[model samples]
Target: MTALLNELHAHYNGAKLDPSSITRHLEDNLLSPESVLKIVVASDSGGEVVGLLAFTFLNSLVDPAPEKRLQCMIKELFVKESFRSAGTGRDLMNWVIAHAKTAGCARMDWHVKATNEAGIRFYRSFGAAPVADRASFRLMLR
Candidate 1:
């Protein structure tokens, strides 16, 4: 998992080791299932993991403010560029969709940069929307 995280971080940031970084944020977030979903990957060629996808589940009340919570949000997700356009992403999405359905998520949400045309097109091919309107602020929970 650590190695896989490193790889994903490297691709996302274009750097080897980034501090105060999303990689740290993700690793710390993974301490509890309440925070994020760490997807499992299978690989050959000596069983090296080459990708990762991290998502956060947020709960909300719809009517009467129920004791339970409504579902949503895939905070972070990625597949290594080398393995892209392969079945790996499909397999990963299959798992995520199933999990989201089981979790009763009203909708699954994620975002890709506007500059990422290939990613946007690939997502569109899956019948998923590529754009989002958001205000992202990092919380200082420490």
Candidate 2:
């Protein structure tokens, strides 16, 4: 959601997020039958979205288990600042975990910013451990 994008921009040293491009991307993915992207939103009683989680299923070459060829990658998880510590995040993560199990995912993965101590602590409470041997890199191509 736009709120999450704005928060991410602020957290990541002022990276810009173009709303139009994001809208186009989301629409394309949501309309494509083969797209693996999945999204979930938590809303208030009045139907205003307060949190959002976006994830996708991916094939892992290193995972050889037949039943677990697929893995779930959490692309983004965000809850409104006002809703933090109110169990909205826990509920969203629980849903995603259940969804992954139902989808036969071998594992679920996500990254937390090093500076995000609260986020790191939250994930750790779920018994999620960091893969110390691996590092993430990205090359943005315009």
Candidate 3:
């Protein structure tokens, strides 16, 4: 998991990552029954984790119904570079889709970096279409 996180960090930020904080966060939330976060991993024949998908349930703010509508947000989806093009990513995504269905999620959402052409193509193969005219913004809290 740490290796995968490091790969993700390198791909996105190109900076050193503090594994301690990530490990602490995972430890606190991963096994907690009350926690909304969940992680699904794909392992090789040697039982080595090669891919992972992390997701969480969130209340949809766009729904106007009285009952709260839950949606799944994919926080991270990654497969080791060596494992790419071998159906590992597809398996991980299918697992997440099944899990989301079981969790009663009305929808699932995730963000892909604009520079990641292969990632976009992978998602499109899954019948996912990008939201038109929608932009993502983030405010870093120090």
Top lDDT hit: 3
Order of candidates by TM-score, top first? 3, 2, 1
- Native-to-model Cα distance after best TM-score fit, residue 112 in candidate 2, in Å: 0.9
**Global lDDT scores for all candidate models:** 0.65, 0.83, 0.84
| Superposition-based RMSD of candidate 2 using all C-alpha atoms, in angstroms | 2.7
Tell me the spans in candidate 3 whose CA falls farther than 4 Å from its real position.
15-22, 29-35, 64-68
Q: 1 or 3, which is superior by lDDT?
A: 3
Using TM-score as the yardstick, the better of models 1 and 2 is: 2
Q: Model 3: per-residue lDDT, tens digit, 25-139?
A: 5667665777776889898998878999988888877895534488889988989889999999999999898888887777789999888999999999988889898888999
Query: What are the RMSD figures for all models against the true structure?
Result: 4.6, 2.7, 2.7
Using all chains and alpha carbons, the TM-scores for the candidates as numbered come to 0.69, 0.81, 0.82
- Cα error, candidate 1, residue 11 (Å): 2.0
Candidate 1 residue-wise lDDT, 5-110, digit = tens:
6677687777666544645765567655565565556454677665555665677655334334645566555666677777777777778778877876666777
Worst 10 residues of 3 by lDDT: 59-68
